[model samples]
Target chain A: MNDLARTIEALLFIAPEPLEVATIQDITGEGPDGIAGALEEVRGRHGPDTGLELAEVAGGWALRTRGDLAAACDALRARPREDRLSPAALETLAVVAYLEPVTRREIGRLRGVDVDSTVSSLLDRGLIEEADRPHAGPTTYRTTTAFLERFGLARRGDLPTLERFELTGPEAGALRARLEHADLIAEAETGDA
Target chain B: MRGTNPAEGRAGDAGNLGGVPARDASAALTQEVEIDLFQGPFDLLLTLLLRDEVDLLELPLADLVEEAVTPATDERWEIDAASQLVLLLAAIADLKGRRMLGEEVEDEPDADALAMREALVGRLVAYAPFQRAALWLADRLRAAERPRYRRVPPGTATPVPVHDDPARLSAAIDRMVVAPPAPSLAHMGVVRRPLPELLVRLRDSLARLREVSFDRIVADCDRLEEALTLLAALELVRRGEAELRQDVPFGDILITGTRA
Candidate 1:
């Protein structure tokens, strides 16, 4: 497009992580409006038809392979398979995402299970970070920008609404029974061992 | 302590039941009956009970408890499962006992018991949805799997020199690992001149000429001697034994013996 847009595009091309508008402004000495316009122009250059698109992730812009081409590119690259988040890890992440600045105690209490290992795993993965609290107490955790980027979410508000997961009286009963049954099966198997 | 069926190898069979994908009504309905049946599957019975089709007082839990506690062949009891069973059994017994006591003669149920149940249900409700949400996020993670470009830091591209000679390399490595020889101070000489001796010398020179240029007193002197002469002159001036004058900046200083 224009000169500023071209410069911003080149910067994005070289950046390892998504580059924020403020950072671009700092580097270019451009005002907010100018930077915003340039970013828009840069984004316009890569449409759905293009192999690479400018993705706005974690409040920053980055050029990445198009969403649909991810599998093909992955195959071509033949890189080691990325470690997928375990179900337990994901559940813990969801807990942190929803009830951020939450303590380990609260997460454990809600899940009705120990979450020490799970919480540490999420921390190691950079999906969650310890929140800074002025008052002294047990540590609290919250989802990080990395978490948003990984999940491809614009913000916490963009998470799917919880209404669909609400359980009716019968449904709740069924779920409880299911949990109990699973527990029973596990106990039986362990005893057999 | 009911015995387990290891021979049946039902562990593999259980995998088919899925892990808490309870949203599938048909699979849940079919698999709900296949697990253990306490008067035709506890889940189905619980559903009917919650829907008010079955009465708490008429649950026939005494027989269920007897069956639950009976020891089967070649089995051991796990405390967790036993404790869970006890809690469930106790809760059911409490509800039945309270209902039988005719505490309200029927209008309202026990608030404390209802609160406890509600709390348990509330926790499950809050947590279960997140499991599904996590799966959704995982799908998004899969979709967003594109390569990102990063700037290769400057000066990192140069390769480190390789030393092929083993003995030289070993010696080099040993040199690196060993503490370096204490820095040599043999080349440096410490010179100290007595201040009083220099003062006497300056006094003699200033007296011999009555008035002498300050630079002339230390003309052939080294740095230490010059520093000592300057200090001695300042001391003599402070004592009112001599007066020194500088005509301009960077000009020679003239020292005159006031004692004369």
Candidate 2:
């Protein structure tokens, strides 16, 4: 059991991206059942109560600092203060991040605001770039390597939970809750677990 | 009595004739009834506010409600009605505190509202930059265009069609669109060739052969699929059907039939 834990920890530490159970199995040469058990044990050892915990993100698992401790991590790293994202930029970024490889026209329609400029800023800041455009009029944009680097992510798949930054005013929260509930149902149908 | 009765009857007739016609009444009803301006409630509201030129800092909610229901503003405009209304609603909400409490209420705008306004302004400001970038990109894209079907040069062998008939080939291409073939491992796999054995056979074959151009041995084989042709050459060397010589720089290979 100790050996399994050590092996799992080592694999997680050196992994380029988050590891799935199947990936862990491949690396450790362990059976699925054994890997699943080991992962569960590791997760149990690092509960939410602790400074570090296991998080499931983008259909894979990674060891992450607790949400509450994010500020501390930021301080410890002495990371430069980032410019506050404007609502438009945030909205545009969210749309691009979630439905990535999306075109400017589609994003504009979604936000009810022209996104050409927002996309330019994002591109200029190396947060987004023109992905190959389909045979369509407008070219598509996708998040960039710098976006991941700025956010301390190895890839786009390392985005934190969408729930964290959801609009939560009275009217917005009510609508969001219903939408989230529907999302939960959908997730259950197609969840990785 | 006869004169009085006629005068009274004339007055009654005049009053009855003064009533509106049924068609005109229906028309009036239709004209007065308000239709929702746009699909999005928010965009419709913004349009109303913008049309009225109402300052965001002095939003008149009651007047807005009245204007929203007015039939005069129900006509479809150039911009999407829904989006207009959404923008109006956002502006109104943003200015709600200011409008209701006076400008000197020692209040700052809602952080989100201020952020949104800044972003919108930023987008407007960056329009020129986006246009410049887009124009540059468009020129680059135009310059990058290549001929769809490059003509095969004369004297060069026409490559064998992967699929024979054009119609069948097009259909196969369409099927590929729907379902792309998975990458095959055939190209990635390592092939073991005993170089020492090959060299020994080459020496043995050369002992009994006369010099020939290197091209003569591979003349019939496809140049692109070099692996298969090289394997065949190795096999020929092993069987004493070909020989390799160091006598020439580029034209070093020779072939001889065992019987010859």
Candidate 3:
């Protein structure tokens, strides 16, 4: 490996969170485009059969253990985590994730319940956050990077596919793009059932 | 499930020689309304219409509105979406009645009831995607959020959002929503115990004595005045006007002047 690739790997190893391309540039005193090349080299070295792999998550690059070793690491550490979210929290989180930039009133309407406690719980857990839009009335919210991290997604746009295999709705042919999410999944999210 | 048997249940209830108790009817109503809450409002409406094999656009507005507003589905999320649907139905029915009658332009109000009906149709059409997306995302999260570690990128050097204290996070959110104070009045009248005064005091006190405890230095200070004096002393130390020493963690911090 070259000097730049080694430096980038070391930097990723030391970083406590995902490092954006811009941040790497500031520290490395290299151009954005140049750092991209180095990142590719470092990522290439840590592939299958390696202990770790480089990932681009939450719109930034990070180095993490390969997926296969997760169980082994947890077993070795014996770290028991009490992190299962309540059903109400999961429902509330789903709303914020998909209909983000949505206000509390909008969420309440969708869920048909007062979501004050659930909202507070999600906020405390670093899942959803106030978008703080300059609106006249109540506050609005959006999901955070931590939310994506918890759900094992690279970014917000990578939400799972809900498309039905068959399309037979009235506007299916004409409104294909608009009605993309309307397909009925055979066995979709557990909550949906 | 209720959609499949609404008629049968109603038929069964009607056949009763003895009228059902008020409590049983209300309990059944609450249970029915609870069913509609989880299913998106648009999806529920579509299901009800589809169960009767009715056309979507040419909906029976009056019948649907009566069902929605009255105790059919037990109205909840009633404040926003339920009410909106009821309003839209009323507006559509009124518009249909007006068209049946003559168009009275002079007496007509400016709300454009026809336009409101069109908007409601558009909204219901738009909601199909949201319902699917919500289910999609929820299933994805449920699958991913197990206790086991999920592969992710290496974190940055300083973790900004990784604070243990939720109060700080909440405070940061609160600050964002609130308007900041004007800079003109900032620190306007803080009774600053001048750094020079603390420096002179430290110089004189240290001159008489080799070193003094932080408490002894601020012994004369009253209430919050000690904080100001400490701030001044720190400023003096920053400028090499004084020195502070500590023998151990959580131990007494000492303040003294330059040996000259």
Candidate 4:
């Protein structure tokens, strides 16, 4: 392969995050047009049908395993259910997740119990962090991406609605899957969903 | 001490006071007096009960009346006296209830005592939302309070021209947007082409024309597929079959007339 193609392949393989045109240029010492042309070539060679496909996500390019291969990847990386949080922890997490930029004082008042230790644990686990609270004496806390990953959420908005608490685990999961499929169908039909 | 007859002293005082009622005179005296006895309702009740030495089960109302009649201080004592009197009345009622019960009469303390504590808890509960609302209000107020002055420093870097007014600006914004004047092609390094057909096409194109427009040669291609194939062919040409122009904007050229 040409040096440009080889450089593009190396970038896709080693990039910690999705690669942008600017980043590719910086790495290959190429201009915007050169990098754009080279990426187009790389993408054309590896289409969606390939084992590894170039995907544009979050405003950048990445070489991702095809969507069909996700189940297999999940099977390989999946851990036992023993690490799941207890009911109390989940409840605390739900409140914090929903009302973030909330404080321990506010949470304690709502739950009718002091949550200092629980908040500390969440912070230690990197599931939540202390966010800025303007003028208030209390320091606000917010959920992190690790929290989303742990909960299998694409983003915070992917969190189950408050109404979902009435449903059983499998029922909720099935509902979530149906919603996701519907979203996919809609995105395919309209190009934006 | 100078009054030989108390009736004559009373008459002289009444005359000096301009026929004001005796009750009014006493009320005026109480108003002029000052006393720091009362703290709050509960504290005042406790103080009055202690002063009267009235048993909790048997409060002496007649003694309380006598105490109320006497003025205590020299100035501004009316407030203290009024609060004390109210407490005295409440204590009397409590004492009567205790007497009627004839035992320790362990009823719950006044709702006011517990009311204070309950109110404190309520305040604590309400504080969170209040603080959040306050923060939101403060943020809005701060945003509204910002000064609109544009005080550029004297020796600072001159402000760059915006595209909004191009007449005052020398350089075109479109030129800035489409960077670097021309695409830098030096980054594309020559390597071996894998496709046999692409190599044959390069030999064919090079033999037909001494030089060709690279973009035009791949213009018929729907996507980047043919362009990439053409790029691979050009790299092979660079390796052996043909030569490339090394100029300001390089284009593909054939050095040898032979078709591979």
Question: Which candidate tops DockQ?
Answer: 1
Clashing pairs in 4: B32-B75, B32-B76, B33-B75, B33-B76, B33-B77, B34-B75
Q: How would the docking of model 1 be graded?
A: incorrect
lDDT for predicted candidate 3 compared with the true structure: 0.61
Model 4 has an lDDT value of: 0.53
DockQ value of candidate 4: 0.01
Error of 4 at A50 (Å): 4.2
Candidate 1 Cα deviation (angstroms), residue B121: 1.5
lDDT of 2 by residue, B112-167 (tens): 74475556444433332333333333343233221011122235565446447988
Candidate 4 clashes: the total is 6
Instruction: Give the DockQ-based CAPRI class for model 4.
Output: incorrect
Q: For all the candidates, what are their Cα RMSDs to the real structure?
A: 17.1, 29.7, 20.9, 35.2
Looking at model 2 chain A, report the run of 10 residues with the lowest lDDT sum: A183-192
Deviation of model 3 at A49, angstroms: 2.2
Candidate 2 wrong stretches, greater than 4 Å = A14-17, A20-23, A31-33, A58-60, A70-75, A132-137, A143-193, B1-260
Second chain only: TM-score per model?
A: 0.32, 0.22, 0.27, 0.23
Give TM-scores of chain A for all candidates. Answer: 0.80, 0.59, 0.75, 0.49
State every prediction's TM-score relative to the real structure: 0.51, 0.33, 0.42, 0.27
lDDT of each: 0.69, 0.51, 0.61, 0.53
DockQ of structure 2: 0.01
lDDT digits (tens) for residues B1-260 of candidate 4:
33334344333443223332233322422322222432223333343443444354444555544455443332222343344444434445555555566734323335764475455445444333433433333343243222111123245566453434665353565656664667777657543344676667766777788665556666665444455765755666667766555354455432443344
User: Candidate 2 DockQ category?
Assistant: incorrect
